[model samples]
Target: MITFGFITIHPNQENTYITEIARHSDSNTIVYRFIPTAIDPATEKVHGEKFNHESGVWETAVFDIPMYLYDRCFYGDDPLSIRSQPIMNWLKNRPYSTFIGLGLPNKWEIYNVLRSDEELAAYTPKTIKASSVPKIINKLIKDKKLLLKPKNGSQGKGIIGLMVTKGKVEALTHKNQKLITKSFLSKSEFSKWLDQLLSSRDYMCQQLLPLQDVDNHPFDIRILLQKNENGEWIEQGRGIRRGLKDHLISNINAGAEVLKYDDWVNALPVQQQALLTDGITTIINKVPKLLEREFLNLFELGIDIGFGIDGGVWILDINSKPGRKVILHSKEGKADELYKAPLQYSAYLEKQSLVKGVD
Candidate 1:
């Protein structure tokens, strides 16, 4: 018998999509779930329930297995929601226990992996941390327009763009509103804003890359890569997400919609198509390799790339555990195949157990 534990950030009610995937697996094996339930853990064993779809009931079953370990497998953002600290410790001490997408690489590590100025062209916007405010201000003067962002931000939450010329700076909120040049005109006001933002969390200043859009809505591509049993990276899914029109960020959580990347790429001018594919391929290959070298345990990554207005490609961001919502949307509910990577990998790991048993 094999022991597998499926967990997530939210409860099963909010994550029906993930539950459906687990329910569809082969029935020859016993699957234990650690989701929160009304049953008592001290009296009722945790690993004895079987899901019944007709009544939406999970009933306890009889089973005794020698292997005692859990796989923190999940499809949602909160995979480590229940007793994570204890679960992590248990997996570390037990033999043959492993986790996927546990913790992601930091922002600085990602930037060092896929930043290519020549390939990015106008899309390779200059960026700096709030700690380097002095240096960033100098660059803002030269570039005339700059974007400020939070260090650990996602979904375009905390970003501000500033326009500058001849020591005069104009501020624009996330909505891209034009100011009257009075409240945020001088360097002192800029310093004040920087101080407040920095006091809470670190921030970065970047040159505004003119990202391409569909129907005036800026869009970015998220390429899903996975390593098979042979340990080769294969492109599993690709889709473009159109952000709320004129917004500084293109994250779907912040009012964005998913589209097919091929649809947009095929419509581009012929002369630029080759350059786009080559650039995307180069980043897709090298970025993952760099992360592998730096963060060896990271097996899967979601690389976000977008095109500048002039057809130049730029790496917008890299998410270690990006939600599968967009990928699910791309396949139009035909995602059972792509969603099987974790299960297939689990089977491969089980083979190791079988080989050792035979020996």
Candidate 2:
């Protein structure tokens, strides 16, 4: 029996719902959640633990047994706000512990190691920052549209696409959600927007690659990867998302629809499919290795791939804390199974990696 603690947004993320199913599927393991609630007369265990309204942390009445742990608490007022530092210190003293979502001891350090546009571009057709946005825009005048994105962002957020028309430049979200319109009209205007956007967050100007369309909507692929019980990183599920008509980005969170990867790939030309697979594989293989060497610990990641009209496959983003809403809503439910593997694998790591009475 292994105790798995959850310090996350929702209690279900503690893997309680999946643990029973996993027990039946896995056979060799027993998993349980540390539920804080009213104590039963017979078991003397608390139930419905109260959320510390003032501190914004959920308090567990009993300090139970959980050899492994997962951090899924990023919702509401943020449970980590009050408990993080002490909880992390306590985890250090525990026999074994592991986390599922983002925010571990040295996460930023790990991100910096794998965060390279050029290294990333080697595998996928990605447009990194070329001198400056104005410079890049000046060159793309012929193409008319370009995309600017923060180097570090997720969920299709902070993506700005610029359209140049008759020497005028307009900015829009990746979904073609119009943000602001202006003429690169003047150097001062371009410089002002560039400075505002660049200073807001680290951004890279990318050449807006063309995308294959479904019903006139551009789409992209999101491959969620996780380490299996065997300790090998495997692509859990690959899903394609079609953006709204005329939108350049295809993130499901941004109103895109998810489809099976095979279904989408089969629809493309054979040569195109091969290029997509090879390009995606090239980046995926290198990214994990880089993360391990630089970030210290990262067991899973969500890799986003976008295809251009010219048939070039591009890397859009890498999400360390991936969203599972699409998978949960997938009809086949394979997405659900795939998503569950990480929690189980994290438990496996806790049992195998943490030696008794040692650091």
Candidate 3:
């Protein structure tokens, strides 16, 4: 029987999704979940949780690292994350094991790649490393608005909106699910605040896009794409994520509301709908292929797309280890498919490896 492993930073992380995946595994395959730190380097065994099919529960067990791995580790500035980085690197380099997706680089690196593609360049935003506080302040002064995003951030964390209004620089961010606004009277004060923010982590600056809805709430289209059993990329689902009024981000974690994709699109005028469809089609068709060509093979992608007030389509973010909340909310009856996807893909990989005599 083939073995599949789900690796996360914490044992409880993504418990629901992991449970569902294990429940869906066929008799020919087994599912296990573990943290990188759980591996015993000397013994080459992992002391982790294994799913018991009969009882439908996860039990503590010790076993060798699974041949196929699903990496769900999200790192932060925490010590655990720092320690796990090297362990994950070691696992990735192991000849006997493989990750379902190798994952993508930081946001700035991804931006540099997408912008270089002629077709993707038009949709890519102008981004620069937040290396100079003075330069960022100058741009905010000139353009009146800019967005500061952590280079490695996800779930709409560490995003700040900077705007110069009425002779004051205002910084807007969400904290504890509440909107927090702070104003600076002088460029020196604003620059000092920005410097402090940048000191903790790397950041990127981009000219703010008009991604707000008619109600002035920020919104974006989130599309989930995954490779099927045949190892071909396909769109699994898409949805509209609407943020709180006057917010900087539309992440679900930041109190965003999920809307059905068809509900949003069908309400638009026929001509506008046609245009939007064509634009979305062009992006979904080209992005997966382009990214795989530029980087390593990936199993899935969560693409965040935005439509500016100027009627321009833009690529907001691309996540290799994507969450399924948007898909589950948007598409009814997709629970089974989503749960079984990893297992099916793992089976395919096992077949390929057997044919090539890798194992």
Candidate 4:
């Protein structure tokens, strides 16, 4: 039998999603289980939990580290990734064991890699490590408006948008389903704010691109791509994320609304829509290939793209283990694909492993 281990960040819950994979899995041929990040390497086992579909509850059990694993763990925060490092090393080092989607990559690492690609570089905005407050001052001077992104942030948290000129700076973020605003009237004031803001974390600075829509709602396109049963990257779906009125961030979990992809596209002017679609289609076709080549062994990507007020399209962010917002709002029956993707890909991995005799 083929053993497929699925690892995630949190512990047992009514994990209906994981259960969906289990329900559809091939019986007698494949045995799969879910494990938490709090694993013990000494025993080479996890307090593996299985979803009891019949009971509709998570059932706990112990499991040995399998030869094949679907690593769905979204590693963030140095301490947790550090804690999981030994286990990661153990699984990756083994000649017989294979892991799909090895682990998440750092945003800084991704930026540096993607920027090296000429095609990709054209759409990516100028980004640099926010190493010092003075350097941030220089970037503000150059771009006039800037965005500060937490290097390891997820779900639109800790993202700060700043609009600057000679005098005042407006800093924006999404908080508690509301827009959080802070103001600084001078470079020294902004610099002082940065000193306190960035003291505890590493951040990347980027030029804030124009995204003012007809109604002035900050909006963007979120396209989620994933590998299929045949190991080909394909667009799962694309949806529009419209921010609350005048808000900076448009993350759905952070209180933004999901808009259907076609509806939003059709609403735009003919010229702008054509321009936006052309650039986005090209990006969707290329980014997955480039990232897989550069990083190697990835199953899915969540690409965030948006257009400037002037009809220029740009990539806003890239996520390895993307959220389900886009899929959730997609056409009828499309949401079914999201749960099936990991399982289908895992089956592919099993076939590949067997063909190579697990070495």
Best by TM-score: 3
lDDT of 3: 0.91
lDDT of 3 by residue, 1-359 (tens): 99999999977899999999999998998899999999999988999999999999999999999989999999987888998989999999998879899999899989998899898888889898989888897888788889999899898899999988898989999997789999999877877888898898999999999999999999999999999999999899999999999998999999999999999999988877877787789889989899899888899999999988777889999999999999999999999999999999888998898889964
Please report how far candidate 2 places residue 98 from its true position, in Å: 3.3
Off by over 4 Å in 1: 32-96, 115-126, 165-183, 214-216, 353-359
Summarize candidate 2's per-residue lDDT along 1-359 as a digit string, tens digits.
45445444345564543443343333333334442222243543324332333453445455444455544433222554344444444554545345543333322333344456456645444355545656765756756777776665556776777887665677776434433444568757877877777766666665677675746687877777777776778876677778777765777767788887776689889988888788887877887666665544666777777777677766666766666645554436475566467556766676666656375
Q: Encode model 4's per-residue lDDT on 1-359: one tens digit a residue.
A: 65667766555332566676676666533434654455675775677765554565557777667656776665566576666656666677778677767655778988877789888788887788999998888888878889999998777888998887447888887778888888887777878888998898999999888786777788888888888988888888888888877777788876778888888788779998888878887888888888777776888888998788888888888988677756687556875678778878877877876789966
Q: Model 4 has how many clashing residue pairs?
A: 0
TM-score of each: 0.76, 0.70, 0.98, 0.90
1-359, model 1: which lDDT tens digit per residue?
A: 44544543334533454455456556544444554332243543444445554555656654332132223333222434444545444544546445543445456545544454344333344556657667777877787877777666565666777777555676656534222232366688787776766677767767877785656667888888876655467777888888776666677766778887777779888877887888788878777666676665554678888787787788777776666767777756547765556556556667766789999
lDDT of 2 at 60: 47
Q: For every candidate structure, what is the RMSD over all alpha carbons to the true structure, in angstroms? A: 5.3, 7.2, 1.2, 2.6
Best by lDDT: 3
Query: What TM-score number comes out for model 3?
Result: 0.98
- The weakest ten consecutive residues by lDDT in model 4 span 27-36
In candidate 1, which residue pairs get closer than 3 Å at backbone N, Cα or C atoms, i.e. clash? 8-78, 9-78, 9-79
Q: Can you rank all candidates by TM-score, best first?
A: 3, 4, 1, 2
In order, the Cα lDDT scores of the candidates are: 0.61, 0.59, 0.91, 0.77
Candidate 4 residue runs with Cα over 4 Å from true position: 29-38, 52-57, 75-82
